[model samples]
Target: MSHSIAIIGASGYTGAELIRLLATHPSFEIKALAANSKAGQPLANVFPHLRHLDLPDLVTWEKIDYSQIDLCFCALPHKTSQEVISKLPKSVKIVDLSADFRLRDPAEYEKWYGNAHSAVEMQSEAVYGLTEFYRDEISQARLVAGTGCNAATGQYALRPLVAAGVIDLDEIILDLQCGVSGAGRSLKENLLHAELSEGTNAYAVGSTHRHLGEFDQEFSAIAGRDVKIQFTPHLGPFNRGILATAYVRGDSDAVLAALQSAYEDEPFVEVLPKGETPSTHHVRGSNYCHIGVVQDRLPGRVIVVAALDNLTKGSSGQALQNANLMLGAPETAGLTLAPCFP
Candidate 1:
């Protein structure tokens, strides 16, 4: 009953995370690892922490024998993912960890990513990869699209309230703090330790963050109306988590009730007691998302907070979760590890 798997873009943060989680999976066997740039190198050479486990050496995606792979996780960047996924074999189920397939409207994808989608037809076939809300669809889909980390964090805090009509849709605002790893394994001047260690600053301000497109698409659909939330993201000095605080005009009790009801049965999402806020540290290195609700001193105003590992629940873990459902395995099969907390 073990599912054969392949991982493309296997040298990136999300790619490495998928390997780390799958290493202990009871029903998944890694059959191939693809990293075009590191094609001939052993995975251990690229990620030393994973040296303990024996895994396939990195190869290019074209070199993989997809006929043997039951599921393939594409951790490539946006435009690249579309181009590559379009060329992949149709028989293998795919879980894309890029922004490429998340937006169904090609125009919206072009608007946010500034490039025309290469695979327009496949766009119609991609099921959004927010595991909790899209579980039923994911289980039946051949292609699943992983959500943006920031978008996932915010949605875990707001989607329930939006659906329950317990909050003012037009007045919602989400301010998030994300760790450096969310930027990926790529090198950048700003990510240097000397430059980022002690400070935190907001980037993608004024609702300019690309994840807003996701918020708009998902929230609007839930309400059957346009719902735009002002979102601002900040890059923190840390290396692994995301914490988002949502400000909304609503009855505090109702907001808590909505969130509790929405995730009461979800294995990976936990709703904390009212007045208790979550922290990024609590869910680091795990597939769990923790959410909390707090009442504002002024009545009818509430603050909802959510935290999760940007690389785990936000991307690879989510992809694997969808893959499990698509393959008929227990949804929590390879994802039950506890969060890494110091």
Candidate 2:
């Protein structure tokens, strides 16, 4: 029962990652690869590392025969994603790797993204794509929205505790550092080697980061209250992962217990032992999330750390995981590869 697939925005980092992971998938076959700018060019032209695999040449999304695609991965940017997804055929199951559909409220989407959602109807039907927490919903959804890499990392560290009422919600603070690739494959002066390689600095400070909208939406829903965490994101001088450290006022033992209980059964999420800390290097290039819990020097304070590849477990890999469930295949079918460690 192999599922035929199409990847839109194929030249980007997440798009390439989806191709890389799907190349070895037991039940998924790439039927189309679309990258409008690179249309008519071989995938090798944009991604030389992928030259070895026999994949279709890049084509524009409008040229694809969606009738033959079992599922489509929309890896386009935010504002553009909503427009493109709104135009895609309804019969095709879509896993959108954009902020467009992650927030259920059209008003909130506009608040964070600065534009009214053009695909409000589809947005209403789109299930949030955080696999661990929304598995059943995703299995039944026709459209699923992938989460922000920084948001995903922070949630894996705090959602369980918030659900269990073991932490002080209002006092929570999440400080995250993500690799440059998390910004995407697009060009920007700040992302150049000379500007970014030798230094690290925090952007989206003062709780202004867009992912804060996700944190507010998800955490508040779990606690049944307005839960706003102080979030600040730093762009690191590397290429592939996200490390998030959450500061919370909770019993350390209880915090660990909550995380371990929530993810003990999840194949892709690994909760490390007490006092252990996770590193971006440990979970690079794989759909695996490593979490660690440690007691703070002061009692009742705890530090929770989570690490994962921003491109894999954060976006494209998450889209693939949800797609498997929507297609009735095992959730971990194409996602069992081990983390790429140093």
RMSD of each: 0.7, 0.7
TM-score list, all predictions? 0.99, 0.99
lDDT tens digits, residue span 212-237, model 1: 89999999999999988899899999
lDDT of 2 by residue, 53-117 (tens): 99999999999999999999999999999999999888999999989999989999999999998
lDDT of 1: 0.94
For model 2, the stretches where C-alpha displacement exceeds 4 angstroms are none
- Where's the lowest-lDDT run of ten residues in candidate 2? 333-342
Error of 2 at 231 (Å): 0.4
lDDT of each: 0.94, 0.93
**Candidate 2 has which clashing residue pairs, if any?**
none
Q: Which residue pairs does candidate 1 place in steric collision?
A: none
lDDT of 2 at 222: 93
